[model samples]
Target: MASNIHYQRADYESGLDENSPLITGLTGRKPELKSRDGTASAMATFGLGFSIMWAQALIRWFASPTEFQPAPILGPDVIEPWRLVSLRIFEALSVGVLLAHIWYCVLVPAFPYLRNFKATDEPHQFTLDGRHVLGGLVALCADGFLNCHQYIFMWNANSINRGVWAKFLPFHNHLSSSRYGESLLWGPPMYVYFCAGFGILGCNMAKPLRKRFPDLSNAGIFTIIWCIEFVMDFVIENLAIRITHGYGYAKTYRPLTLFPEQVHQFPIYESVFVASLGLVFTAMRLKAYDTGRSPVEAGFEIWHPSLQGTVRTFAVIGFSAGAVLIFYHLPLNWLGVIGDCYADMPSYMKPGPVE
Candidate 1:
């Protein structure tokens, strides 16, 4: 009886009494509780159910079916000596950057005891009331899946290459602009990175292991997420060049087919989706820290005490910008690097001509 009485009193105090208009009025502003308000606002912002409407719109706007150009038949052994050397040099530089990140991020701090380690849990981190990490993941999945489909069409058009899955990569042409002669090297690698790296990162984030490591405090889930994001970009874009082209062991690198304008728009959708996802996670990290959790306690927190909130605010902004810059500039960078290398090569060994 006393328990029931206490419950009734609490209900009244929280504005849940039968006569309280706050309880029934849909638009009235009631005294907001953190959990309730946060949950409501998050759902409003990134509701899983709500995204479907927009997803369909994006599909309609972007996924235009188009014919592709046929690929030229060429053998790897036919590649000139100087062009081969240039590609090797570029590969070495990429490998160096990736190796450095692994040593610093994975080996240096996490070695020996393997301290602060955890996979990211999407359901726990991205619930309607939780971090909404899943919303970001869905965006990535959508961007990746659609881009892959588009590439599939590109691969199909080339009589030289097999169907989508049969070729190592499809839509290799859409990676960079055809503005300069540099399109040869830049076009394919970029999308390969998007397809392969993001594919792994997305898969890792959605893994069951990530779910088991629910508490962010015990491990650096955010760092893991960031690293995965970076590496996948390299793999899908850079290394994918080798995979499809068959460098080192392969006989040739040739475009299977060219993608039309519509499919090339993947970067726009991917940039938006990933940016939104990162923002939601940053909010969660801040929310956890705001509750007096230390960076150590809030495993996702990446800054020190004095600068936690401020740093995160900036980092989120920087990361969002970085994503845009990457999507915008990487293709350009790849083009320049590839072209400069090509231009520097002897005229007899240029990409368009062979000795």
Candidate 2:
């Protein structure tokens, strides 16, 4: 009997040891595993959603959330008071929807890679890759909302009030103006660039994941890039805000702008939450890379989704910062170059009514 077992079980015993299972007196065929399918994917998604919801709820509960407040340094002339309320409504709705969608669609797929969200070895049919691309759309929507709001705010602030600049602080008005055209040029184009570029990358990357790098099993690289962008935005924005508005302004500020200063004023809970999400995204991305299978495999795996989702985000903010720092230095240095254009230009260029 033992000889028969050795002969017949040669394939299974090549790597076996004493610890192997004992043979049963009676035997029966093991059942086949059901294939992976959409239902399994949806269940995984639901669990992820629940965890995120609870986490966000807990964070919000501890910190008193702030409303949006817009303070255009150009003053009332450029940013009309009447428009402020409407803009705030739009900003809030846009941000809420964008955030919710990202968490629901993109982040959920990554749950399986996380130890906490792991399921049994059930087979799954759904690709769930669409969620990754969907993330880019959410990000683009966020960019658009911010751009339109900023443009409207700048136009009104510059046109409406005469003394608004003097009332706010020194550099606030200047920063606002710099952000306008940059947002316009970069904002809309980003939507298309992200969706198209990453869409292609994701499709190609999925092929090798099953065999070469199964760990590259989750959300892939796009998610990670956006996570990085989230961190960069928080740090950079606050610093820029401080530089433009005096340190004093950071204290009393409410939410007219899409960002709520009140939220920033307290225990830093908001910052932590944002940072945590970024880290989670990054972790998922690495999992998608699956231990660096190959350059092309990694490229196909991580590059596009991360790029489409995050590159534009950082670029837009970076462009805004660059505009402020560089433009401030060069006044006029041409054939007819002269002194300060803001002070010397005609009434139209100067802004405000004729003196």
Best by TM-score: 1
Best by lDDT: 1
lDDT of each: 0.32, 0.31
Model 1 error, position 85 (Å): 1.2
- Candidate 2 lDDT over residue span 111-212, tens digit each: 434324666453331122333333333333222122121122112222221222111222223333322111222222233223323233333444454356
Identify the runs in model 1 with alpha carbons over 4 angstroms from their true place.
1-77, 112-355
Off by over 4 Å in 2: 1-34, 37-74, 77-134, 139-234, 243-267, 291-355
Candidate 1 yields a Cα-based lDDT of 0.32
- TM-score versus the correct structure, for each prediction: 0.27, 0.26
lDDT (tens digit, per residue) of candidate 1 on 1-355 = 6666544344555546666664456435443332133222222333333345335533542342221222332333344455456555555554454444334433534342333455533222111111122222232322222222111112111112211111112233444211112122323333222322343344456344358777654246555655556544434433433333322101111221112122121122223334334433443444443453212122223335565433333333333223433443334333323321111111211122110
